[model samples]
Target: MALSVREQIADNSRIDILSAAARCFMDRGYAAASIDEVARSLGATKGRIYHHFPSKADLFAAVFRHGMDLNYEAVRPFIDLPGSALPRWRRMAMSHVLLMIDTKPFQRAVWIGVEMHLRGATTPEQRSVFNELIEYRHNYGMLFRNTLLQGREEGVFRFDDLSITNQLMFMTLNSPIFWYTPRVGETRSDVEGVAKKVVEYALGGLSKRREEGV
Candidate 1:
């Protein structure tokens, strides 16, 4: 269902707070991030943040959810496309990598949120929210996993371990967030070109060789 007008405004304000908070977390560690800092980054006051989120952890959780939602929305279109699973999977992977490059702040927040979880920085309440986001991330991962399984069934891809291979594929796709920077003259097409090349490299590892004629 569509959001009502008031709900839409509230969501927009919430996203504004989340973006500011994400930048704060991205610049400093999440544990070091403070609501005051996020407010300053947004040129707003702490009350503005508190108006939306009750705590820093809640704001962080919102950022994590926002980042995950962006990923899901970006690649969700290609997940169920008809035709060979390999091609559909490639498009999804490419779209994901492109989003990681384009949406650096939110994607970085995602990595930082994972780091926070690993370091035991979250309270029980925050952990609850994080766990829910984790489930969403798992659902997103399952789309690729299912596609990989289908490709394997068709003899289009070769992998020894399904679970490990799925994780490896995502790791490879997510790695660009660590080192990628947009060039001075680069366009979205240029970024997609690079993303496509990266996807091809990863897919090539799993695909059967044309010469083998599977």
Candidate 2:
């Protein structure tokens, strides 16, 4: 069913809050990003944010979830196509990199959540949220993990450890969120160029068969 008018307004307000919070967290690390800053970015009061989110950590978690949703949407088409694993994986990985560049702020917020969890810096409530996010992440990783298995079985790929290779693959695909900055006169072509390079670099690491060239 479509959202009621009041529900639609509430949803829009929440999305605005999340978008501002994501950009705030991206430009400033979690330690420095505050609810007040997000509010300021939105040109609204902190109460507006608190009305939707109980705390800063909660807002961050919401952003992380939104980021993951974007990621799933980006590659799902490629993952679902009926074809050889090699081409499917290539398309998925390329789309992943393009998303990292297109939605840099949200993607960076994802990395910040990982860092906060690793450092044991999150509150008890935040830790619970992180645990749920980690499970989502694991499930997401398994999509690629399963593809790698298919590729290996077909003698089209080489890898000793699926988990490690999956991590390495993401590290390459996700690196653009860290190092990529839009040039002053950047265009869609520029973004595509960067994603193509990143996709090839990641595919290279998989060590596929000679006939199935990157």
lDDT of 2 by residue, 1-214 (tens): 9999999999999999988889999988898899988998888988899999998878888999999999999989878778678899988888889999988899999988888788888888667889999788778777787778888887777889888888998999999998999899998998899999999888888876577665
Backbone clash numbers for all candidates listed: 0, 0
The list of candidate 2 runs beyond 4 A from truth reads: 209-214
Candidate 1 lDDT, tens digit per residue, 1-214?
9999999998888888888887788888777899999998888889999998888877888888889999999988998899888789888998899988877788899988777777877788677888787788788888787889889999889999988888788888888888888889998788888888789878987887888785
Candidate lDDT values, in order: 0.85, 0.88
| Cα TM-score of candidate 1 | 0.90
Clashing pairs in 1: none
Model 1 accuracy (lDDT, Cα) = 0.85
